[model samples]
Target: MMMMQKPLLLLAALTLCCCITSLHAYRKRGCHCIQTTHNQVPRKCIRKIEVIPVSGQCRQTEILITRRNGHRVCVDPEEKWVLELLTKLYSENETSSRTNVSTNASSKLDA
Candidate 1:
């Protein structure tokens, strides 16, 4: 029975290691990693770039950010500036869409 118990313990250890390795790989694959060095601060140094949906891939879809002058910038997604930009852009898009819908409805009523 002692030999059987040792094999079971060894199996459990191997299973734990496999689980840990798999989790690490999953997180690495799904995570949006910032490849920039730790010292870069584009948010503080450069201005915020306006996100235009119709601009036709002004940036690749991978959390790309830009400076105010329409130049590419890299920043952490968690940064305050990135959050503010996201909020501002979302609000503008929402408002503009609402305006378009209202105008369309009003025009149909007029006709």
Candidate 2:
């Protein structure tokens, strides 16, 4: 009975250690946003933004924006400046598109 108890305790200890190790391994990794630019100025510097994780690991999320022109933008909730910049960019893009459409329609009407 004593030998059996010793084996059971050893197994329990090993199991506990394995569980702890797995938990540590599963922990999230931190990440920061960086800017890329086609020209001299780095996009990050112009944007003045860095992304931090709001929940979980930053790498685990797909928090980046890709422009049609092949520009990459990072997204993170912790970076309010970046968020605002993105919002402005979106608004401007939408406005420009709308204006172009309106201009085309007007030209068609004139024709």
* lDDT tens digits, residue span 7-105, model 2: 999999999999999998975645534543223323434423222334454443224444445555655443555456546655665666654323321
The 0-to-1 C-alpha lDDT of every candidate, in the order given, reads 0.47, 0.47
User: Where does candidate 2 stray beyond 4 Å?
Assistant: 1-4, 20-28, 32-53, 58-63, 75-111
Model 1 agreement with the true structure over 1-50: per-residue lDDT tens digits: 99999999999999999999997786333322235322344444445432
Indicate the worst ten consecutive residues by lDDT in candidate 2: 102-111
What TM-score does model 1 achieve against the real structure?
0.32
Error of 2 at 31 (Å): 2.4
Q: State how far residue 34 of model 2 sits from its true place (Å).
A: 5.3
lDDT of 1: 0.47
CA lDDT, candidate 1, residue 101 = 23
